[model samples]
Target: MTTRHSHAGTPNPLHSLIEPRALLEIAALPAGLPLLASAERGDGHPVLLLPGFLGDEGSLLALKYFLRNRGYDVQTWGLGRNLGFQTRHANALQQKIRFMHFKSGRKVSLVGWSLGGMFALYGAKAAPECVRNIITLGSPVSMGPEGSQSPPLVKAIYRLIAHPLGTHGHLAQPKARDLREQKRMPIPMSCLYSLSDGVVPPQEATIDGDPALHENIRVPGSHLGLAFNAVVLNIVADRLAQPEGDWHPYEPTGLTGRLYRLLTHKSLPL
Candidate 1:
């Protein structure tokens, strides 16, 4: 049996090459709006949407617009392109989280895609007070040897551009200390990954922790499509829409709920 934390060998290299398939899901977004309309709406909470590494706010426009239309105060990571985690990125992200929480007069719900999702998890631990909920799309739980399952080429490219990605951040402490805290989420945390994800492996994206505060949901889409995929957005909306201080495992019930379950045929992780 496959445990939630199992690596199950390296992820398939083919998925990394076929990441372009995400474009199809993006193209299908418009047609899925009607279905999204049936999702639960929150109490006009604030949401901070973060893009994957190297991507900017523009990459997340579709999902941001979708959430905004649903009555959410959706905003982007203000620090331009996600240029790997550096001192500036860490400091700015911390300030952004605090500002969003204070400005909206509500705790900010974080919605991150790919590398952005990893950043969200990091931010949540550093500033748990400001973050109300955490939702990640195809984000690995750890970038180090512990959880990374990216293809060798992907890792090589990332290392070439941005060395020491996770080690240096706002909450950069003893590596072991940080890892320990990361395992214990102080707020509701949900992870969504696709079985056929082209970049992030399903195991790496899933979390192993307390059932009360953590859940790993399997969506159906390419890694690049996580931000625009209808099902992914729907799950984020429903998770963020939960009443403040109230969090629960996600089950298919929104407008696209049945379609998601039918397509993925996954029982979900809690």
Candidate 2:
């Protein structure tokens, strides 16, 4: 007898666990925070951070603080809101990249979460010479029916809230062309996904094409927790610590890697 795995409309179990946690995290996040006062002070290359869906620059404050404290020139989009996909957001991102390059006089690194990740990939594809490395957290780069593991109620709410905004105004549906084009671009890219993510499924985070240029790191945490989880933070720090032209695959070592492997084994098949 043979068992067949299905990737149809079935919801991911890990994603199922992430919904309530993400809601709680979002509610607890403080609003109207200030931008990095001295974004240009860090020693290494500059890093541009993008937030997930329905998330503004304020949502990434914790991650920004963490990187800043670690001595990185981190900057936020400073865009008013994260309503969805709009020409204005894209243009702002492009401008930010150009400004960073001009000011730093070096290729910048981009760390985007969810929708922000997609934007970062596009930015790299459009201008490969400007980006040094790219990192995405729980981004849905693969376009499929089961790309997202969000609960039905949550999905319903997103559709209800975002549908009226129209396709152009709202976050456009994931496209295979975008993923294909992104893969063709030559950039050091790392995708960090959690098996327990409640939003985007782990499989959607996998990149096809060259394994050397792309790496997939599996972390133990919920989708919301990934944005500020200690384990994820260490992984981000390790990745950012590397010098340009010296990218290496992330291998979690010692106790943390072992513990993460043990806890997330049921959800991720290595």
Which stretch of 10 consecutive residues in model 2 shows the poorest summed lDDT?
31-40
As a whole number from 0 to 100, the lDDT of residue 254 in candidate 2 is 57
Model 2 lDDT tens row, 148-226: 4445665666566555533222434444245445564677777887666666666666565455567777776667666
List per-prediction Cα lDDT, in the order shown: 0.76, 0.66
lDDT, residue 107, model 1: 92
Each model's Cα RMSD: 3.0, 6.4
Candidate 1 error regions (>4 Å): 1-7, 143-147, 164-180
What TM-score, computed on C-alpha atoms, does each candidate reach? Answer: 0.89, 0.79
lDDT of 1: 0.76
Tens digits of per-residue lDDT, candidate 1, 1-270, equal 112545565566677788888888888998888778887776788899988977899999988888888899989988888766555676678789999888888899898888787678767777889999988888766544454567776666676666745323322445334644575577888888777786777777877767777888878778888888887888888898888877777778644666877878855443
In terms of TM-score, how similar is model 1 to the real structure?
A: 0.89
